[model samples]
Target: MTRAEIFKEMEEMFGLVPSMFKSIPDATLELEWSLFKQVQLAPGEIPAKYRELMGVAISAITKCRYCAFFHTEMAKLNGATPAEIEEAVHYAKSSAGWSAYVNGMQIDFEQFKREITQVCQHVRLARESMGPGDMSE
Candidate 1:
């Protein structure tokens, strides 16, 4: 789509053409906007609320205050609670910390992957053996 066409659609959908779209390079604006709409605004298997929450976590880890705030607001619009946003940020911190430790220590990648596989297999087996709502060993 041409930049003009994209801007028309954006205006129709958002009631105004956002400055962000106008600021992008003209050559790739259509592609970028298409991708953003498909991934961020469209219905998908991941669902928008969860995706927004994930965006918040990723934004937090990547130190993008703009994305963090945008995604947090979108998450709320998509039904995420304050508790969920807090937990997402907390999980992102924990994950980033663990990744930093492992990468810094130069842990074996193959062993880590194998351990993760084993853990998943064990958890699947345990879940299969247990009845619904049964978490006790």
Candidate 2:
């Protein structure tokens, strides 16, 4: 699609074409907008609410204030409660903290991967052996 076509479509969908998008080169505008619409705006395998909540967590970890605000509002638009958004950020904080600690400590990567694999296998087997009524997600 041409840049004019992409801009028209963006304005139609968003009520305005964001200035960030306008700065994209005309040659790359269509492809860039296509990817943003597909992955960020569309609800696919992951429902929109959960996906936006995940985006919030990632934005927090990456320290992107702009994306953090955008995803938090999108999460609300998609029906995430304030508590859910807070919890997602807390989880991100915990995960990021542990990652920093582990990497800083210079832990053995091979051992960590092996242990995680074993834990997953064990949990899978345990879940499979549980009775239908005893199983929970």
Candidate 3:
């Protein structure tokens, strides 16, 4: 769509076009732009590339067309190649298969809960390590 057309849509949706939306205008344009910015700039355990890949993975698994397109675009901007993005999606699918297999093999909700808890703990640790205090003094 034309830039002017996009801005017009953004105005209709957001009441005022956000700066980021100025580049791509659409409905909830401001919210979309803000989310993109947060994903890039937020302090988190995951590196930006990993976050981008994660977004792509979620998009792939959930089949969110808009999110897939937006995240793939962001992934490229963050230095992920198209191939790498594809690889991430492949891995996500593979992981899903692994999860299903494990669930079936054990048939125990407790076991699955423990596994999830461990994974969440790891994520928390990683996020903590990413904080400013963790940086070299």
Candidate 4:
């Protein structure tokens, strides 16, 4: 679509054309809008609530206050609880902390990958061995 056509569509869909869309260069507007629609605005395999939560987590990590605010509201609108939103932020922080530590320590990538795979396999096997009502002992 031409830039004008995309802007018109965006205005119709959103009731107003956001500055973010306007800021995209005309040459790349079509591709950028296509990706934004497909990934951010559209529902896919992942539900909207989860995707919004992820957006919140990433925005928090990136320290993008605008995105964090926008996505937090979007997540709530999509049925995420306040507790769930907070938990997602905590999860992001924990992951970032561990990532910093591991990378700082210069852990061997091959060894880390092998250990992670082994741990996953162990968990899968243990879960498979359990009956439907069985709790791990």
* Ranked by TM-score, top first: 1, 2, 4, 3
Error of 1 at 120 (Å): 2.0
Report lDDT (Cα) of residue 36, candidate 4.
87
What TM-score would each prediction reach against the true structure? 0.89, 0.87, 0.50, 0.86
lDDT for 131 in candidate 2 is 77
Which of the predicted structures, 2 or 4, would earn the higher lDDT when compared with the native?
A: 2
lDDT of each: 0.94, 0.93, 0.77, 0.93
The 10-residue segment of model 4 with minimum total lDDT is: 128-137
- The model with the greatest TM-score is 1
Identify the runs in model 3 with alpha carbons over 4 angstroms from their true place: 1-36, 40-45, 104-106, 109-137
Give the distance in Å from residue 53's predicted Cα in candidate 1 to where it truly belongs.
Answer: 0.6
Q: Return the TM-score for candidate 4, rounded to 2 decimals.
A: 0.86
Segments in model 1 whose C-alpha atoms lie over 4 Å from true places: none
Each candidate's clash count: 0, 0, 0, 0
In terms of lDDT, which candidate is strongest?
1
Candidate 1 colliding pairs? none
lDDT of 2 by residue, 15-123 (tens): 9999989899988888899899999997699999999999999999999999999999999999999999999999999999999999999999999999999988988
